[model samples]
Target: MKLLKEMIHPELATRTGRILRRHAARGIVLREQDQILLLFTERYNDFSLPGGGIGEDEDMELALVRELEEETGARDIQVKAHWGYIEEYRPYWKPDYDLMHMTSHFFVCDIAPELAEVRMESYEVANGMRPVWVSIKAALDHNLQVMSRQEETMGLSIQRETFILEKISREIIF
Candidate 1:
């Protein structure tokens, strides 16, 4: 997998601690007209790509399809291309899990109009994850605002998504 981007928070780079490794699969769902499918988390007040952590020994493509359907009720997904991957290093993210090293695989996908009812996980419902479609530019702008905020209340996942969206906006949108 190509390294699309690597981000180490200023604080994390200076911290001396053990880091946990995690891998996730993410997707970029693009409609023919440039609309992007996104997951909006009301709890976090942020938007992210429709995908999640790859299960133990799970195939990356299968995990991406499963996550997209689970989160967005999407169907007839055709992964057009591999959108590369990103890595993030975060410290002080959690008390028990002091450090986190996450690598995310992203895919460019197309979904059919007919979709099954969304089957969200318990935690997803609890966190207010909902599917929404917006223009690529709008998504990028929203994420840019989130990234520019002084208070870092957004999750690292959202931050990573923001970076990915910026790249997509440059390469795909504009």
Candidate 2:
């Protein structure tokens, strides 16, 4: 999230001007044996990556680890590489409020294949955040819906599903 505060829109003075502080978030594009980790969020019942907003002044790397643990209970993750960033301009949802811009930091992580036997948090489980492994290509081909247009842009644009698929092709034994 620290990386996001550095990005600015041409029109607005800054996120500070709107009284909305910057939020940093991290998502690990977990891959194993040619399969990408995905979650079927109960809220909208859609498949998406695992991540959440970073608290004020929170360390993004720490936040990423915490979010991954909270959402999927996967430990001992090895961050393989950084996939860079994506920016979106809108509140996560609830269109009535002032729009927010989010900068998402994405990383490619390696997780134990056995962690697929997940322990979903009750909060998230109640809301439908279930772990699923899908082929990199399959995840891209599905009718994926991010929380919002901005969120979709923030997630999908970082690696673009095509690029991720290519990388997955060489790394995992599909």
lDDT of each: 0.83, 0.56
lDDT of 2 by residue, 1-174 (tens): 223223344444444424343455445555545566766654653556676778887877777777777666667776666566656553333444454666667766766556634555578777766877777666654433342333532332223333334544555434
Clashing pairs in 1: none
Steric clash count of candidate 1: 0
Q: Candidate 1 on 1-174: residue-level lDDT in tens?
A: 689988887667553467678889888887666688999887777888999899889999999999999999999988888879988887755677678888899998989976679999999999999999888778777777776784356765667888888788788876
Report the Cα lDDT for candidate 1. Answer: 0.83
Candidate number with greatest TM-score? 1
- CA RMSD, predictions in order: 2.0, 6.2
Q: Estimate each model's TM-score.
A: 0.89, 0.63
Off by over 4 Å in 1: 13-16, 92-96
Compared with the true structure, the alpha-carbon lDDT of candidate 2 equals 0.56
